[model samples]
Target: MSVPILKQGDVLIASIQSALTDRDLLQLKDELAEKVGRLRSRGVVIDVTALDVMDSFATRTIRSIAAATRLRGAETVVVGIQPEVAIALVELGLTLDGIATALDLEEGLDVLVEVMEARRRDR
Candidate 1:
């Protein structure tokens, strides 16, 4: 139950294998903060497709993770949401609306790289 971090064309990609709950949220928060800090660029991708269920704790933890990343001046893109989870979230009217999501890792990376490239151009 840990998050694995990798680098791809200046983007930081992270995959979490643990169920998100209060008991594990603290560890996740700590590790994610550290990993985001270590990233070489401001673009990051968080893949949670393996997550079986998303409760309030899970939702809030992901929000926290996104916030933490943003605070470090990094942008987070979530990818690979299970179809059932998507339907559940919609049915429940859950608001993960503020966070950016992509269809898959490839799409997520494309979005990240596009945004990063835009930022580079602006700089």
Candidate 2:
């Protein structure tokens, strides 16, 4: 199923609630990029609180989404990673690297807002 992507002011929020296939990730990337451009979004928050598995494909797909959004001038923040998922990701040698992360959706939104504001001030 396609994930729900919502718009909150200038930020786009995508919450993943089930296991995702390769197709889902690709669709998400496309939809997010389209939304960011159409809405002129300044930030994005991807909430994975309900996701139980964090495989290599999922990791790479998320990072790809972040990078694509960044290229469109929107910062991305991932939120709601469970403890086990975190450990699994680490054991699998997967690090999020340049992507920003938060403990929960609320925090993720806050982080995105802060980063966007900082960027605005820098210009």
Candidate 3:
């Protein structure tokens, strides 16, 4: 199933509130990219708090989404990662390397705001 994507100001928030299959994640990436471009959003916050695990496929999908969003001129922040999931990801040697993360949805939004502000200043 596709996740819910919300637009708040210039930011797009996508909450993955259920366990998603590979196909679902692929759909999510497509939807998010489309929404970002259509809405002209400057940032994206993906809330993954409900996810119990962070497998390699899921991790890669997130990375891909972030990269694609960046190319579309939006910053992506992933929030609500459980402690166990973080530990498992590290143990599996998947560091989610270049993706930005936050503790929760509120923090994620703040991070996105900060990133957008920085971009504005740089430009």
Candidate 4:
């Protein structure tokens, strides 16, 4: 299934509504990367609240999505990772290194704002 990616000001929010296949994940990564550049987005929020399970491939793809968007100058935040999913990822030794995470969409956006503000201060 195709994920719905919404643009909120300078941020792109991809809310995964259901379980996705590897192909779907890759497509999401590609689409978000392209949108980050095309829309001049400064941040991205990926909401995985609905997903009950996340395998290594899903975890890796999500990480790659963040990495790919970062290369396009957007900071990515993953929000709403279920408790069970988080535990499974840790058990599998799949880490979401170099990525920011939040409890929900609101918190995720706040994180993005802080990150953007920090960048502005640095500049």
Candidate 5:
């Protein structure tokens, strides 16, 4: 199933409501990248609260999504990673290296706001 991406102010919120296949993950990455540019969004928040499993492919795809959107001039924040998933990713040696993360959607948006504000100040 296709992920629903919503435009909230200058941010695009892509909430993953279920466990997605590799194809769905790739589609989401592409869709978010395209929308970030088309919508001229300053930030992207990906909520993965409902995702119980985040395998290597999913982790890599999410990292690529962040990198792609960043190149398009939008900051990306991933939120709602469960404790078990976090431990699993760490044990598997998969890291979300350069991507920003938050505990929930509210914190995710807050992080985006802070990052956007910092960028503005830098400019």
Candidate 6:
């Protein structure tokens, strides 16, 4: 499985296709962390439509990416979560309070643009 990275206007959109198991999670995590620093803009949209599950480690990696992106003066947004996975996350008592999520790519891009615009003004 390959992770695709695309630049969408002012946003760097990363799509994690196929299954995101613990084995490959960290590789994606590392790449994401690296992108936070290299991104031309401080806005990211991580498309998780293909992800069927979010284990503890994967959740941890997402948290780490969020933290790292924020540290780099950027924001991370998760998009298109599988219904069951969303339910599981809630049952697990996971809090995505600060993390923004979108229902699809279009919405994710909209949110990313808004966040990036706000960041631009602040900086």
- How well does each candidate superpose onto the true structure, as a TM-score? 0.81, 0.96, 0.96, 0.96, 0.96, 0.86
- Tell me, what's the RMSD of every candidate? 2.3, 0.9, 0.9, 1.0, 0.9, 1.8
Cα lDDT for residue 98, candidate 2: 87
Model 4 scores a C-alpha lDDT of: 0.93
Question: Any idea how many clashes model 5 has?
Answer: 0
Q: What is candidate 4's lDDT per residue for 1-123, written digit by digit as tens?
A: 999999999999999999999999999999999999999999999999999999989988988888888888989999999999899888999879878999999999999999888877987
Clashes of each: 0, 0, 0, 0, 0, 0
Off by over 4 Å in 2: none
On the 0 to 100 scale, the lDDT of residue 39 in model 3 is 97
Superposed model 6: Cα runs more than 4 Å off:
121-123
Pairwise lDDT winner, candidates 2 and 4: 2
Task: For candidate 6, write residues 36-72 as lDDT tens digits.
Answer: 6776557778888988878777778778877787787
Model 5 scores worst on lDDT over the 10 consecutive residues at: 114-123
Whichever of 4 and 6 has more TM-score, that candidate is 4
Write the number of the candidate with greater TM-score, choosing between 5 and 6: 5
Question: Can you tell me which runs of candidate 4 are displaced by over 4 Å?
Answer: none
TM-score of 6: 0.86
Instruction: Judging by lDDT, tell me the better candidate of 1 and 2.
Output: 2
Lowest-sum lDDT 10-residue window in model 6: 32-41
lDDT of each: 0.76, 0.94, 0.93, 0.93, 0.94, 0.80
**For residues 63-94, what per-residue lDDT tens digits would candidate 1 score against the true structure?**
88878877876677889888988888778777
Candidate 3 lDDT (Cα, 0 to 1): 0.93
RMSD of 5: 0.9
